[model samples]
Target: MAERLPAGRLVAAQFAACAANHVLPAGIGASAVNLRFLTRCGLSTARSATALAVKAAAGGLVRLGLAGVLLLAWPQTPRLSTTIPRNSLAIPVVGCIAVAALAVALSRPLRHRVGRVARRVLTDVRAAHGRRSRVCALWGGCLGFALLHAAVLIAVVRALDVTVPAGHVLLAYLLASGAAVLLPTPGGLGSLDAALVLTLTAAGAPGSAALSAVIGYRLLTGWLPLLPGLLVLALLARRSVL
Candidate 1:
């Protein structure tokens, strides 16, 4: 029931989607593109939306788990000792979690509403994949992007003449980038820049050096391809591919 585009157009649409993701807030661009792609692949609107939501939730959970592991495994460097709070941060985090849990527990109507959506999503998944393969594939792609993003951070730090542990940089990038998702800004524009700079500085990098690294990372990952991606989007749109 969905229209299929040529391979070239499909690739163009993907690039355009990536561009849109960098240009829009709250990841709407990526979600829109993904839904469009899935629909083109013959999935229904509900199934495509459900798949995207499931992928995002799964990615968030994985990032959170990774952050926890990094916090436990890595020792706080001396540079971070003064700026990082050990006890104070946990209280707010725990309180927020408790409040959220209590609210969810108390709101039966809300739960029922969400339950219907969840059931429908599951039905769509079962009808398509019969297993969790689609979710797994989405997870794999998310992890791959995170790793590449971390690698970009490492490169930026090194270029700025900063010496930090590779593992630490990777962990910091992962955590900061994940946190940036909470603030919806175009391509995480200002929000991501601030978060990454703060994160790197907290990780012991000099503030100025961290700022430079963040700028470089953003230029490489967000800004550089923006125009090209838009151009691709235009091409696809003109060809009636998107």
Candidate 2:
């Protein structure tokens, strides 16, 4: 009986810790996600939209910084991708800018409606949690962390010496990651690798190259990072911070 109590306490503490560590980032991601959907459904706000955009930008900068680190540590690693033609780069960059401008232009009216919807969603979410709001916050943090991660995955893949278009990689990731939500596994382990490989292959990458890239990415983004997460969870458990 005593043993069981300690185990239970351990689980609860880790859950609490994970939740506590993840709120602001998750809220930022959720707000952006919410605004994206709400805009389509007739709700939007500059303040909310801008907040999410900033979070996205902050997240992007973090990835860019990581890329810079890779350049310093393993100069050859970044060469995994094919060099983009100068002409192609200009067109793609222009297209991305146009899309951003369009999104902003479309947001003026949509933002007002989204604010109301966000308020309503919050009310219901709060009601659903009742006394468990902290748990919800922790989950939100995990979510923020995940969204930031997905963006990084696409970025890393591009930064590697590959030839596929970034847009295609992003789209493939969006679909696979979305599907991974309902997949019954911790961190979508097998599904994510499968999805990434298949998506990359479909985008015209050779089997060997795709496999190598995925393996390298999995090492950095998965196996290596997990050691730390496990260590953190373990230490937290011993300290009864679950």
Candidate 3:
């Protein structure tokens, strides 16, 4: 934001948004809250949206980069096995591309909006790269975010006395989390649990241990902060910070 905001309020806003995220699907709640906070802090809607886009893009790239690096360094790490034919996979991929192309071709407003957003994102990316502090904050925050989540899973695994290696646990978390994005469930509810269990089990942890890890992870990440998060949300609302 160009207009300076109080750091305390900014932190509160983030806490409130994190709590709000689990109540809605695919983080819509968090995005809406952040967008509102940015606007309240005096940014235009387009700029706020661009900022969010940059953040999301950075986080996604970091996850992908980490997974790639881990896979390369530890080639023995288990990968998700699928029996689906390679040829069959192309059908959905091509269909998605075709559908997107057709929609863009036929919808004038959608095309204009997409073009505008693309231009804004490019401009913001260049501007962000020029600022060393901005670059550090963006990538560092994303990397830290991913690592913290992985640490939680690792802690859970260790607590349960499971025999999975830390590298395998981290790799499994990254892959499962990346896959969970496709489902768009609230806090990745069912989708994350299923993917995590599968990935952990595939990584050679026993089925029982993998399931326990998922439960423990969910309890920490989801159920634990919920009430306090809601309380913080209420406080923010009362203080008119949101």
Candidate 4:
């Protein structure tokens, strides 16, 4: 983060990483590309990985925070319960917590590893927060990106003449994006599409319209950038920048 990296190369690396994301689950492809790029720019591998972890943590936290705020503002929104049935969500949630706790308690090595990773991530988070520039760049970028994606989904819904409220659409998009983390599909391909359509439908959108909106969103966000991203990736590779 302290190094003077070339702005053009940094942008190129991000473009290439987005293209790479379609092949790897979750965001492994992008993370690997960013890690390599940072190391190439003279950062240590450990620092580069920490920077990525911090960025990811910021993104996740921002999504959850925005959703929470929205829910608080519009308590009557039906976006959440439609995704998971009312009165039926508690069992699985509690069961997961119990199972995770039991496993951690039973496994010493796992506990130690978890503790080490947690501490490292916490240290990285703290260090990033200590720097005002890093804090602004990290959280602001994450927040802006999440809002832009939500706005896209809303626009798609409106263009299709869906009747769902903008707040509801925003909340639905956030919830679907959060849920998609569990599936870890490449670039959230099938999982996000399914979750978003389901949520949108539950929020009073017609099923057909919801599906169309999701498809349109994917085309704009995923497919459109893919070819250009790949070209950038190839060029970067040829230049030894990737």
Clashing residue pair totals per candidate (backbone < 3 A)? 0, 19, 0, 0
Which is better, 2 or 3, measured by lDDT? 3
What TM-score do all the candidates reach, one by one?
Answer: 0.79, 0.42, 0.89, 0.85
Local distance difference test, each candidate: 0.74, 0.50, 0.83, 0.85
Q: Write the per-residue lDDT of candidate 1 for residues 90-178, one digit (tens) a residue.
A: 56668887987788789999778768987997776565455465545556777776778889999989887898888778777766766
- The 10 consecutive residues of candidate 4 with the worst lDDT sum are 81-90
Using alpha carbons, what is the TM-score of model 3?
0.89
Pairs that clash in candidate 4? none
Models ranked on lDDT: 4, 3, 1, 2
Report the lDDT tens digits of candidate 2 across residue range 1-242.
00012445434444333333333332333343334433433434543354345445444454444433433554442322222222433465588889866775789766666667567656544543455554444345445664566566666666766787655554445444434333424445666677667656765667777777677767766566555555665565466343
List, residue by residue over 1-242, the lDDT tens digit for candidate 3: 22346788888888888888998998898998899888888888999988887798789899888977887878765454331122443465588889988999999999998898888878878887887777887899999999999999999999999998898889888888877776788888898899899889988889999999999999998899888888998998887777
- Model 4 whole-model lDDT (C-alpha atoms): 0.85
Candidate 4 wrong stretches, greater than 4 Å = 2-4, 85-123
**Ranking of predictions according to TM-score:** 3, 4, 1, 2
What is the model-wide C-alpha lDDT for candidate 1?
0.74
